[model samples]
Target: MKFLYRILFDLNKEIEEEAIKEGIVYVLNYYKNEFILYIQAYMAEARWLNNNYQPTLEEYIRVSTISSGYCLITATCYIGMGNIATEDIFKWLTNKPKVIDVAIVLCRLMDDIVSNEFEQKRDHVSSFLECYMRQYNVSREGAVQEGRKRIVDAWKDINKESLMPTDVPRPFLTHIINLSRFMDVVYKDKDNFTHSEGEMKAFIKALLLDPMKI
Candidate 1:
C-alpha cells in the first residue's frame, strides 16, 4: 500500500506539472496546497485515533474518506481549470462557482461514507444527487435534471462571457459528462476493488491534459 500511495503521489505531481506547463498553473497550485492541508488533517486525525481508541474498520474508513475527499476536490479543480484555460490564455474565472457547488456535495457524500451513515442500497445516488438538488431546492429527480440543465446553461454563459465563442468546445462538455459517469460507476462498485491506483493516476492525467492535446 505504501508503494501504491507513492505511485499515486508521483502521478499527481506529474499531472500538476503538465497542467502548469499548459498555463493552468493556478489550478494545480490551488489543489496541491489543498492536498497538503488535507494530509495534515488526516495525520492529526490518525494520531488522535491512535491515542484515544483501538483502530477499527471505522477508523480506516475515516482515513480513506479524507483521501477521497482530497481526490475529488483536486480532480474538480483540475477539470474546471483545464476547461477554462484551454480556450483562452488569460480569460479565467477566478470564482469557480459551479466547481464549488460540486465540491460541497462531493464532500458531503464523502462524509456520509466515512461516518457509515450512507446506505449502499438506498442512499448512494440520493446522496450524490443531493448536492445539486439541495442547491436548487428541488427533488432528487428534479435535481438530476437540473444538474444537466445547468451544465448546458453554464456553457452558454461562458460562451457569452468569454467573447470567444468557439474557444471552449463541445468535447470539453462531453469529457465532463464522461467524468461524472465514471464517478457514478466507481461509487456503485464501492464494495469491489473496481479502482486501481494506476487507473486513478490515469484519470488524473486525463484531467490535467489540455483539451486540444487530448
Candidate 2:
C-alpha cells in the first residue's frame, strides 16, 4: 500500500501547476475517506461473523456494493486523461449513475451465487443467498432461483444504461458493462477466481503462457 501511495505522489507531479496538483491531492484525500468507509463496512461484516449475525437483504446489498470494489474501478475508468472527462463529468458520476449501480449489483450477486457454497463451509459473512433464504423462509434452491431472477434484472438495467441519453461517456459506461459480462463468465459454474485450477487456469495459460506462432 505504501508503494501505491508513492506512485500517487509521483503522479501528482505530472500535473503542470502546483495549484492543480494540490487540488488533485485534495480530491485523492476525499476518495481515501470514501475507501476507508467502504473497507470499514467489510471489516464490520467480518466481525459480525463472530456472533453468527445475519444481515437483512437491504443491509447485505448496501455492504456488498462497496465490497465489490466497483467504486474504485468506476472512478479510475470514468475520469480518464481529462480529454474524455471533465469536472462536470466527475461531478455527475459522484452522484452515482444507475448503470454503475446495477453493474456492481451484478458483480456482488453473481459472486455470492457461485461462491456461497464454499464460503458457507467456513466462518464467512452472510452472503446474499443467506439473506434471501432467511428472509423468505425458502430452501437453498428456491433462494438461488430468485437470486438468478434479480441477476437478470440487473442485466436489463445495464443494457438500458448502454443505450442513448447517457449522462457519462459511452466508453466509460462500456467498461462497467464489460465488467458485468466478465463476472458472468468468471462465476458461471463456480468461483473460478478463488479456485483457478480448472478452466480458468487453462485460459490463463493460453492467454499469457503459451506464445502465439508469430
Candidate 3:
C-alpha cells in the first residue's frame, strides 16, 4: 500500500506537492470511513468458497459496487478533467453524487453480465448471476433474465440523473455517461478486457494507430 501511495504521490508531485498532499488527505479520509468496505468486497468470494455461502442479490450488488473502481475513476476525472473545474466542484463530485453512483452501478452490473460465461470456466469470484441464482433458487437462464433487468434499472438511474438539474456542469456528468458507454463496447457480448485478442485490439489500433485522411 505504501508503494501504491508513493507512486501516486510521485506522479502528482509533477503537478504540485500540495496537491498531492491534499489528494492523500482526501483518500485517507475516505478510507478512514470506508476502509472495511474493501475488505468485505475482496473477501466476498472467499466466504463463498469456504462456507458455500452465496450472498443475497442485494448483498452482492452492494459489495460489488465498491469493488467496481468507480471511486478511483471518478476522483481521477475530477482532477484530470477539472483543469478549469473548481475545487468546490471537485469536492462535490468526490462526495459520491447520484450521477457517480448510477454510473458505477451501470459499470458493475454490465460487467458481471457480460463476463458471466467466461468467468464461470475458472475458479473465479461468485458473480451476481451466481448470487441471484442461489438467492432466488433460479436456473441460469432465469438468473440471467433477472440480471438483465437489474442492469436496465441501473441505466434508468443514469438517464434520470442526466436529465435532472445538477450543481455540477454537464460536461462533468457526461464523463460518467461516456464511461458507461465505453463499458458497453468493451464488455459487450464478451469480456474484451481480459480476453483482448480480438475486436478490442482492433479498437486500439484504429483509435491510436490508424491515420486519418485529411
lDDT of the structure predicted as candidate 2? 0.76
Ranking by lDDT: 2, 3, 1
TM-score of 3: 0.78
Number of the top lDDT candidate: 2
Q: Write the per-residue lDDT of candidate 3 for residues 1-214, one digit (tens) a residue.
A: 8998798667655434444544533443333334345556767756766786767778777878887767656655555642455666657765788877777777887788888888889777688888878888899889878767867887898899899998888888888888888888887677888888999999998888995767
Q: Please, what are the lDDT tens digits per residue for candidate 1 over residues 85-107?
A: 44232232222334333433343
Cα misplacement distance, residue 26 of candidate 2 (Å): 6.2
Cα-based TM-score, every candidate: 0.40, 0.81, 0.78
Q: In candidate 3, which residue pairs get closer than 3 Å at backbone N, Cα or C atoms, i.e. clash?
A: none
lDDT of each: 0.47, 0.76, 0.73
Q: Ten consecutive residues with minimal summed lDDT in candidate 3?
A: 24-33
| lDDT string, candidate 2, 139-189, tens digits | 999989988898899998888878868876677677777778878878877
Residue 58 alpha-carbon offset, candidate 2, angstroms: 1.2
Candidate 1: the clashing residue pairs are none
